[model samples]
Every structure is written in structure tokens, then in C-alpha cells.
Target: MNAVVFGAVLCAGVAAWVLCARDEAVRRARTLLVGPWGPPGPGCGVPGLRRLDVRVQALLEPFRVRFGWRLGRELLCLPAGLVLSVAAHSAVPAVLAAGAVPLVGRWLRGRESRALAEERALAAGALCSAVAGDLRAGLAPQGALAGALLREGWPGRPALADAALPLLAAARFGGDVPAALRTAARLDGAQGLAGVAACWQVAVDGGAGLADGLDRIAAALRSERDQREDLRTQLAAPRSTVLMLALLPLFGLVLGAGLGADPVGTLLRTPFGLGCLAAGGLLEWAGLAWTARIVRTAEAS
Candidate 1:
């Protein structure tokens, strides 16, 4: 088919994919995370096709995980390719570009997720350390917690700060130290902190010591922090390789389509060529799927 007709078909297919995804979301009572080439919303799309998306997502997840890339870019690229195909009037280049978009998107998403996760983990660790030290130095748990949170400039600090006001009220008006402690714990991003606060709250009600509990929490947080860093280090090399492998074929295919022999176009032009093209696409997808599986297994190991 000519580029215009091919692009229209491709666009129609994408539209169908999107519509199906939307229907599936509706049937399942789940929010649609995104609309075709649009922003995400919860429970906005197709339910039946979400399973298909999960399969696609699974294949893409490893690449996104390893490369620190955004899934959105890969997603956007498909529509971009369709639009580009229409504009380029060249089926080969458009098809090749369309195929490459997801890899790029996942890589971007992975990077963003990694950075955010690290920051939160580090903040949790630091908050743990600061609270332990401050409490030991005779500061009330609230004081220590507030100071730690302030120092970190946490992304969600405003919400935590707002939560703290009612907690402070609970301590002052109700004379309920336990309730206050629980509130403080909830405000902090540290899940372990909640446990510690609960313990202290109980201790306050019953007149017990919390020094030991605080020490244990600090130690645990520190250990967890170290483990996360070590895991990141271990995965670094393999992640790099996964990204390269996932991207290389896409780049090569596109380069071949655009610069080398126009096999994609030939495939479109002839029945035999079409069979070969379909086979090649299938093989390419299989290889990508295999590489993604390997990456995930390696990451898990």
C-alpha cells in the first residue's frame, strides 16, 4: 500500500487498539492510565484488552526497568510514527520508526522511576537516622520527626506537615501521646517509622522505655538502605546490556528500512515479500520478547 493508505490503516489499527483498551477498562471497572496519544486517567479505557496491554507491558517493563526510561515515550512513538508515516509518505521509514518508539519510551520511564525511587529510599534512610539521633538527644519524637522532615525537603512534605498539625493537637488537647506518635509516623514516608511510633505511643500510655525500639529501627533502616544501593550496583552492568540489546535491533531495523534496501516497502508490494516481512516482524518481536525475559530473570536473580 502507498504511504497514505498504509498510514491510514496503521492509524486505524492504533485507534482500534485504543478503543479496545478503553472498553476493557470499562468492563473491568479499572481506570484507564492513558488515552491514545493522551494523558492517563484511572479507569478510563477498555477492560478486555487490558490483558493484551499487560502482555505488551510485561515485554516492555524489563527494558523500562533496566534502562530507566518512560513507558510513555514508547507509547507516544507509535502514534508519532503513524503521523510521521502520513507526513513522510514513506511506508518503510514510518513502520521502522513506529517499531522503535516503545523502546525509547520505556528507557525514559525507567530512568525517571529509578531516580525517584533512590531519592525516596535515601530520604527514608536519612529520616530514620535523624530521628534516632534526635530522640536520643532528648527531643520528643515529634520534634525529631519534624526536624528530619524539614531538613529533607521531601516532595510530599506539605501533606506531611498538614497531617502533623492535627497530631500535635491530639497530643496537646487529648493528652494522648500514643495517638500523636501514630500521626507523626504516618506523616513520615518511613513505614518502619510507623511501627516505632506505635511502640512509643503504647509505651507512653503504659510508661515504658522506647530507646531500644528506636535503635532497632535505625539499624534496620540503615541495613535496608545499604541493600538497595548494593542491588543497584549489581544490576548496573546487566541493565546497561539489556538496554543496548533491546535498542540495537530497533535501531538496526529502522536504519535498514530507511537507509538500506526497502524490504518493508517490498513486503508491502508483493505477496511473497509480505510473508517475509511478517515473518521478520514476528522474529524481531520474538527476539525482543526473549531479551526482555532474560533481562527480567537476571534482574530477579
Candidate 2:
């Protein structure tokens, strides 16, 4: 009776570690990647990647909803691949494929983000050129702003179409240019833009030198852009190291499996192996969560 009771307790513990406990760990790790709790369901939106997000989110729904958290698209695929691997009675391909999804997503997102960023940069550059030309022609800040709005054909014209143009019109009809730029800043989502608009607003409102203020604001933007670039360069190496570190143990397991080692069979069949697999999966998720937190901190800074 004693031995039977011990064996039952051990089996319960193993089951908890593999299915129930690991799912919880995966969910917690996901919450770290996305903002708190996510969209409250399986299908969530990832801006600019809706279709892919929905598919991945659907696949991840079971793990997430059951565990009360969200998971990264990449991590969501991992368990599915793992389950498939076990179902197909193969472990090596499962782990490798699971790990590759996130890396591929990251690469694709990075490329797209870079292209969008370049568009924004070109828009800013055109806006600066207009400001410079207007300044050279002795236009007051209000006059220059109006000219830029009326000029048309500038990159990101819509950025100013609604708020800036209407504000400039009001200024021309005897309203405040500073107020208009401030309104523009408020409407658009970029702080640098708001800051530039505010600088112009202050210049016009306080009767400061319009050209000098524009130059100063542009200088500040240039400094900020430089700092962001430097930070990205600094972060690249450390982020790669973290990813490589995370994959090391999983790859080692895969290597064992490829060598015809029965780690999966043992993991599924034996109480000790199951507990270890469960513990390892939890630890892997915890490590990824920790790494993600570090990245978030860096990004916020």
C-alpha cells in the first residue's frame, strides 16, 4: 500500500509538471512579451501583421486562455511543434522548428520597421528643407508654416493636412500660429514633431528669433536620432547572445534525439524524466521571460 501511494503521488507530480504546470509557465512567458493579459482571447492584433497574428494567435489560444496569459507568436509555435514532434514520434525537428519561428518573425518585422522608419525620416527631412528655405526668404514662422502646408507634394503630407493646415489657415485669418502648431503636435503621435511644433509655437508666441529656434529644434532632433542609432548598435550583440544562450539546451536535447537517444521516450514514460522535462520547459520559459524583461527595460530607456 505504501509503495502504491508513493507511485501515484509521483505520477501526479509528473503530470502536473508536463501538462498543467508547463502551460502556466508558457502563458506567463507570453505576458512578458506582449502587454499584460493581451486581447482577452486567442486572436489578437499585431499592428501591420494582422493575418499572421490571427493565425499564430489561434494556434496559441489553447495554451494562453487555459493559462490566463498571452504568448509571443514564436513561443506559441514552439509547444505546437513539440506536441507534433512527440505525436510524430520525433523530437529533433520539433525543437529546431519551434525555435526558428520567432527568429524569422523578428527578421521580417525588423525589415518592415526599417522601411517605415525611412519613410518617416524622409518626411522629416522634407519638412526641414521647407523650413530652411522659408527662413532664407525672410518669412516669419507663421508665414513659413503656411507656405509648407500650401506647398503640397511633400513626403507624409497627411501628417500636416488636417491639423497643421487648418491651424495655419486660422493664423492667416488672425489666429495664433503657436497654438496651431501645438494643435498639430497634439494630433500627431511623434514627440519629436510635437517638440518641433512647440519650439515654433514658443518662438511665435514669445517673439523669439524664428530661424534660430528652428535650427535649435532641428539640432535636438539630430542628437536624439544619433542616440537611438548608437543604442541599437550597442544592443545588437547582447540580444544575439541571449537568444543563442536560450537555444543551447533545447538544441542539446535535439542533438541527443538525433543520435537515437531515447530522451523523449524516457521523458514521457518515466516519472523522473517527465518531471525533469517539465522543470526544464518551465525554466526555459522563465529564462526567456527574464531576457524579454531586460529588452523592455532597454527599450524604455
Q: Which regions in candidate 1 have their CA more than 4 angstroms from the true location?
A: 1-75, 87-118, 155-190, 205-212, 254-260, 267-301
Positional deviation of 250 in candidate 2, in angstroms? 2.9
On residues 193-283, what C-alpha lDDT tens digit does candidate 2 reach at each position?
Answer: 5656666666656876666666666676677677777888988998899879976865675677667786556775578876887798789
Q: How much does each candidate deviate from the true structure in C-alpha RMSD? A: 12.0, 12.9
User: What is the C-alpha local distance difference test score of each model?
Assistant: 0.55, 0.55
Summarize candidate 1's per-residue lDDT along 1-301 as a digit string, tens digits: 2464455466546645543332222212222221132223223266555566666665666776799643532474566575755555446546776767766545555544444344444555566677678878998766666666556553233223333445445534555555554555543343554666666666667766665666777677778777666877987887688658656744554566666566445555677876776787787679768866875676466
How far out, in Å, is residue 224 in model 1? 1.8
Candidate 1 local Cα displacement, residue 110, angstroms: 8.2
Q: Worst lDDT window (10 residues) for model 2?
A: 17-26
Q: Where does model 2 exceed 4 Å of error?
A: 1-129, 138-143, 146-177, 183-189, 268-271, 299-301
